[model samples]
Target chain A: MEWDWDFAWSIMPTLLAGFRITLIATFLGAIVAAVLGLVFAILRRSSNRWLSRGTSFVVEFIRGTPLLVQLYFIFYVLPDLGLRLPALMAGVIGMGLHYATYAAEVYRGGIESVPRGQWEAARATNLTTRQTWLHVILPQAVPPMIPAMANYLLAMFKETPLLSAITVLELMNQAKSVANSSYRYVEPMTLVGVMFLIVSLLSVIALRWLERRYGRVSQ
Target chain B: MGDWAGYLTLILQGAWVTVKLTLMGSALALVVAFLAGLGRISHHAPIRWLSTAYIEFFRGTSIFVQLFWIYFVLPMTGAELTPMQAGVMALGLNVGAYGAEVVRGAILAVPRGQHEACIAVNLTRWQRLRHVILPQALPLMLPTFCNNAIELLKATSVVSLISLSDMTFQAQVVRSQTGSTLMPFVTILVLYFAMSSAISFGMRRIERRVTRGLDGVR
Candidate 1:
């Protein structure tokens, strides 16, 4: 019940190690989300009707479902289907796959914000479709999306605790283990909460900076 | 088929719990959202500071951590809470922090001309907010509020970790008992998707109804 500084100090190393894994999972998962989300965004806008509709359905389904359930499916059912993944790998993929739906929305918004005039101008100048996208559309689209994407990064980081459910040794998992072993719930749980608070607050400050720098453009 | 049917019934019972948590949590979140959101823009500095602190602290920590702390550590400090109570509180407060921002933004987005009109008529601040500002702001808040409601629904899944026996927890129970991982997980995923879709659908209807008279203002 009482605050035990010694107990908290003793568990610091274990919690820190777990925090390292949390950071790694978040970083790798962000990469997966960024790339996959872009792919999803483009595919949803494809010329083929079936491809666009199918992509939209998949994105909607993923967005509608909970990340925790998605994590459970990837970690539990995949092994039964003869595809085993380590907890961290499964966690990363689940986080990436889940957040990708959101990131795709950001990308879609950014892409849509590029004016019709720009697309017409590209065509009038005799730019090829690919060149129009590469040289003009994306250059205009990507900047505003950065802050939204970074917000999701922080969101995924907060959710790294959920990775503990799938057995990843993230900060929450380590704290739980320490709590279980020592039969002391207060210190470790509070520490985990404090750690998350610190990281999220810092990321929020960074996101504000990003917004100020890139939030407004002439689109 | 019989065994599967039995599993479905059990999972439905859990689904009921999930629905209850989502509804109760969302109701509490709505109250907290309005309070903190309005408080943030209050005339007094301390009121604004207090709301800001409330929003930042809850928003900064993940809901899972908050649930565990409430369920586990809060009792140590003498405030015992049932799992359901804790789930509702954590989900409400956490999601409320987000809803607060939405409320603030919507209020701010109301045209500056509208505020000038309120002052020109010599309405008190409370009368202005209640009669003029809130009516306009309420419609603007609906779409984002719909999204936040879906978010709160998904968040109820995390309450399962605290042994709350929400749909996610019941799925685990079914999985362990039947030794069938896919069925339980798949069923709940569909259920969750359905619930979220329902929230969006209902919100859309309300949004349409609310904006019916004020066509060009939006």
Candidate 2:
């Protein structure tokens, strides 16, 4: 049918509430991705060949597959193995794990960009490996990573719509239910698109700011 | 293992559909990328504005929403598309928007001196683009284009929601039939990885061929 302004107004609150969940999932997922990515990057850099190769394989597997299927596997297949997660948790983890591969690559690049002299200097001072990583490496490497990491944060935010596939009450899912019951596809769906566009545009501006502020670190 | 042989056949059929969608969608994305990319750099104001709007609209929204809008909403407006049609369109258009930026960046990355050289030779704008610009820009574009293609392939998995019977959809079917979520899911996951690795490998070869004899510039 035709678009209706009043109908749109009536559904605004529900969609906004769904928007909150979408944002929360994205926020939590970004945190998970950042932390896990660091873990993966470090493990991949380990001197132990098996540990590094296994980490690399896992990262490539996650990177190669679709997030939607990963969510399915996490939500559905995990239960078969006696590990159950709430739908939102599964979605968040899946998003995080899927994007973590990309983040790991970013971290690897940042970590590698740290000059060999710095690593040598860390050893030259007789600093422990942990101390060297904590005091010298991460502090220098992490700033340059902020912009790239922020870009993934925004990317993950856009991808929150995929959470709807696992029955998460995110914006897209809310819009679908609204359209299903109300028989008005135009307004809810269009509004969902608009909501995503606005948030993404704002994130782009913020990412540009981040790049300007932190991108000079590696150089 | 013997029982899985039958399920494997079904999944392979589904993989075929996924392959078709990826191929068709990527071809469409490549065409749109060039058109919109060139349009973005065009001297005409309206062309540039239209291209920017198109790119922004597609890039800003999620591909899942785009697919649903085309699959669910479009039919209400009296235009009906088969699930496959909607899936391919959404994947192509969505990825094409991102590819356009890659195209624009690559073209812009061409050295200023090349453009100046074309101007000095009194080459027409079209000739400058055809003979001087794209050849240089193409090598740069290939790497990112490969990434975009893999992204589009992953995106086709979402079409399973619309009942497109791609690999993901077939996995769901196998899951329901055998009540074995792990097997079906793992099977499809491996299939996806294999497909993506193949794309990556092929693209690398193409990139090498394209960049041949241009190593110094790149």
Candidate 3:
């Protein structure tokens, strides 16, 4: 029960190795979420009713379910359907896909914050839709969303532990393996908790800086 | 089809466990949310600091780590918790940390006029909070509380890691038994979505009923 410094020291390398994978998963997953979320947001706003509605339903369904279950489906079931993926890849994709729905909402909120006059002005200037979006709208819409998007980044970072459920050898999984072998739960579990706490606190500090710099979207 | 029905029944039993965990976890979370939330704004410095620390510590760590620590580490200290108890405690404390912020924000959002009116009427602090502040704040908290409850529901799936026979865990059982990976996972996903949608729908109804006569409020 007592804290074992020696044992903790020995396991540090393994845990850190796992932490590296965690960071990589989180980084790749964030990219996927950011791009796909933008796509979903845009699709939901499309003039075609079916496309908009379908995208909306997809977002809702994804948002409603647990990431753990999604990860399970990807890791365990997909191979049966002839689309087998490595555990890390599946975890990253599952993480990205689940969080994309949340990120889509953030994107939608930012896009909506753009003024109606801005759109009309784009049309008035005879700017092509692509030029209007690329030059005028997104430039305005995206900056204010940085802070909110970063919040999800931290959320996704914390959720990286769930990636362990799919056997991705992330920090939680690494810690569990150590615990199972050594029969010393206190050290590994405590270290893992501390590691997450330190990163989360630092991320929160960074989030505050982001909020200050970006000036959050008003309401 | 008969065997499929049996699998469905087993998963539904697991779904019942999931519902129980959600309800119990949410109940504990509500209490923790109010106490820690109000504590964050307390007159006493130590109480405020304690509340802030509790909120931050719980919020800063992921729930999965917290659950594992409670289930595995705590037993070393001689306080062994059943898997169900650990799940409820971890989910409650984790979501409660988030809910505390919601509680604090909603309470703060109450108009200054209400507090001034309480003072003018010479209402004691307890009376002011009970009658004036909380009544107005409750409606504001409900929407976010609904979201947090759904978060709690999703979080219960993490308990399956600790060997709790919740829906996600049961899906694994079904998968192993039936050798149909797709059906078990797909079934649970639908069940989870249904539960979350129900939570949202129920919360909206409660919100409507609460805000009925409070025009210009909420």
Candidate 4:
């Protein structure tokens, strides 16, 4: 079959809309993750054993399972308890929550990697715990986390296709809808693949540069 | 949804398929990963580029989107494989990309001093890679390899979209039949949790055993 640029171009309108949703959902979801990860990472290292243990359990629980099923629970099962979130909201929530667990470990590793002498210096200066973390440790920790965080961001973008299962018409959903309605799987999916390739290649290049730049600083 | 008889039977069926696919797919991905991973770090520029391209293409694309392409596009292209084949192929390819990273990282993680030691001992390339490098890399790779294997298992649910009778598919089937979406899906969710947790728990034991050998080396 010959390639059909006209057909591919027409579907671009819907696909673009879906791409917007996918981008927003991923970007916003990543923000949630960055915050939740910091919270859980700190909680896991807290002085209180109960708080640390409880946070660890929650993180492990979320990380151990599939995001798809978790999203199903958020989107499908949650309504049973009379809390009906919008499909997009539920999707971002599920994706954010599931990835937060993984990101928390990343944060923990970043935090713990600070040299012990740094802590001693802060202590010697009579810095509060908050002051020490904000001033002494975090600035040292966050740069290395940037590349890892970028990887997660790209991963989250790829995962936006899953939100379609919950009726959020992200990129893949639009491609599927076009395929289903037009009875032409060839062009739309091909275009979708190209679009994904472009986006993710950009992600790779951006991530690589970030990794190299911050990697030098962290070391 | 502790309706034991119903959920148990459904999840059991899904669990069987999940385990089977994870094993089969990971097995395939591992074999290819070793080659591609080595290719990635090869002295030959073309070999390195080829592996890098392979990794980036799969890594960049959504696994579910790839699943759809295999399931939908391949049929239109006249390669009429089953849903299972498409599902397995997508997953093996996806995990293979990740496994390449693990393998390459693990190899690089080997101490540079060891490479000098191998050279000083007059070890051949194959001997150094097989007897020295890979042995050390295996233990380091195991934890990450197993994690990807579990993620692939969780990913098997995507095959349900193409009509594979996987766990998520079974859950969907049960939900539609019973008109009770929450219970059916909740049961499926718990089954995934149990299966993944079990995999991680088992791998953790193995990680401990592996690390035990390396203890006090530094």
lDDT of 1: 0.93
Worst 10 residues of 1 chain A by lDDT: A210-219
Please compute and give the TM-score of the first chain of candidate 1 against the native first chain: 0.96
Q: Model 4 over residues A104-166: C-alpha lDDT tens digits?
A: 878877887789999999999999999998999999988878888878888888888889898
lDDT of 1 by residue, B15-61 (tens): 99999999999999999999999999998999999999999999899
Model 3 chain A is weakest, by summed lDDT over 10 consecutive residues, at A210-219
Classified by CAPRI criteria, candidate 1 counts as high
**What's the lDDT for all of these models?**
0.93, 0.92, 0.93, 0.85
- Pick out the ten consecutive residues of candidate 4 chain B with the lowest summed lDDT: B1-10
Residue-wise lDDT of candidate 3 within B32-82, one digit each (tens)? 999999999999999999999999999998899999999998888999799
What TM-score does chain B alone reach in each candidate, compared with the true chain B? 0.97, 0.97, 0.97, 0.90
What are the per-residue Cα lDDT tens digits for candidate 3 across A1-219? 689899999999999999999899999999999999989988999999999999999998898889999999999999999999999999989999988998999999998899999999999999998999999999999889999999888889999999888889989899999999988899999999999999989988998899999888643
Q: Which stretches of candidate 4 lie over 4 Å from their true place?
A: A216-219, B1-4, B112-124, B205-218
Q: What are the DockQ scores of the candidates, in order?
A: 0.88, 0.84, 0.90, 0.70
| Candidate 2 residue-wise lDDT, A1-219, digit = tens | 778899999999999999999989998998889889989998999999999999999999998999999999999999999999999999989999998898998899899888999999999999998999999999998889889888878788989998998999999899999989988889999999999999888888887899899874321
- On TM-score, the stronger of 2 and 3 is 3
Shift of residue B32 alpha carbon in model 1, Å: 0.1
| Tens-digit lDDT string for candidate 4 (B86-175) | 888999999999999999999999999999999999999999999889878888899888789788877888887787888887877777
